[model samples]
Target: MLRTTLVAAMLLATTPAFAQPEPARVEVNGMHMYYEVSGEGPPLIVLHGAYMNIETMGAIIPALAESHTVYALELQGHGRTTDIDRPITYQNLADDVAGFMEAVGIGKASVFGYSMGANAGLQMVIRHPEKVDRAVLASVAYDAKGWQPEFLAFLPQLAPEFFVGTPVEDEYRRLAANPEGFPALVDKLIALEHEPLAWEADVAKIETPILIVQGDADTPSPEHAVAMLRLLGGGTMGDMGAPLPASRLAILPGTSHTALMNQPELLKALIGPFLRGETPKGMFD
Candidate 1:
């Protein structure tokens, strides 16, 4: 019923000269994945950040749907997707995304990932390069250690109950009940760490075109974005030296972690042309 409603909404919106609708719910590895597909060009898969659902990408969807077949997924334990029985890890999440693509009959698709989803996107590209044609890593970090300090300082004050095994939804509700609980939620997220991947080594293996987008105010610093670009841009090394793929890094002015939601024009300015295979003019280039 949910799938039907979304598809009907999309069709109604598209018929009067909007984008075309291509909606369905696909089951992969015993998990039901909800996705809304639109438009009719090259496939583009969108992955949202941690603690966010597919709806979080709503702000940027319409623009991308203009020219590409956009597939926005709700990661495990987010939105309508059921939680995994085992503890979640980046690799597991990446595999789930890859399985989803295969189940949907997508041979190769461009991936767009935001925040935690961006990290997962990197894992997918590294672990299953053949499935990805291109990628966009938005507000991502290559290292988890660099993020610990900020998370430590903020956790204790927010939702202490999360430490006692509260479900994610309950924790969110508790935080919502007391706005001050937000910090604790961040701490819990930071505390739940995954084994770090040797990003430099893994990035060197990526041969697909990539676009790295970061906001001026993204946490842990803008230097992270620069690091990603250098790693993926081949740096001083030539083509033979662990050669990086074709990529571009765009740092939007006065933006933050939620740049896609808050700055649609800028988001479109960077992504629209890139999906179309046209070079983004000026700063985006």
Candidate 2:
């Protein structure tokens, strides 16, 4: 999927007007994390994908900013944030997110995370439920097995040299506090991809409302998305007298994991109402 993301990043030329908000740095989880705050209203933290930064999020940040105060972050080893000794596991990243919220004075906030960010957000909702009001997890999977076979096959072959001439490498060198650490960062992330993780039971117990978004042709299998929805109290026949589930699922057509970031209008239309607790109106309702 990193290949898909590389192509998408290369295609992304027009940066959003709100993309360059002055970033603030804070010490969170023993790392100097860089984040930018924009818009107004309730706090909403936007997390970027693997090897991505806030600027790579495209127009989605401004779209979300229209309603919520968007706090876009560059996680460990990415963007302006320098690397630490710790491995890039979801659990560690989730803890970093919780610590960041506390440092920023946001007791509870909604989360919008994509790709690796989404997986970390899932862990956050499971491990630190009290800190998250709700979440939007895009292209997320419960375990490594949830990914498509092709994507799984591509992981072991991933190397830093694969990104040398790509935008991901270019952006890393352009914004990283330690630009030379790009190879190390890529190595750690590849290790993360190989790490085992399964949270079905944990996900089933989460009380926080969640919206699972994925593309029909994304890395995470469609079956896995549906299974995750079921775990989140979704996948019910609401029109048949069953109550609406606290969580929801959205599968965007003609979109890939990388292309999902480019769909600002579609994402805003779905995420805005969900975060505001506005349920969709049906004929039966």
- So what's the TM-score on candidate 2? 0.94
C-alpha TM-score for every candidate? 0.75, 0.94
| Whole-model lDDT, model 1 | 0.64
Evaluated at residue 116, the lDDT of candidate 1 is 69
| Model 1 error, position 168 (Å) | 8.5
Residue 158, model 2: Cα distance from true site in angstroms: 1.8
Please list the Cα RMSD from the true structure of every candidate, rounded to 1 decimal place.
8.6, 1.9
**Tens digit of lDDT per residue, candidate 2, span 141-186?**
9866788898878777766677677767777899988878988988
Model 1, span 1-285: residue lDDT tens = 011112223222221222444556778767677677876689999887665555445557767777788898877655556554444556777899999988989999999887768888988998999999888887766764334365435534544353343343443343242434444434434444434444777876677778888777665367766777777763343444343336777888886454434565678788866665674244323
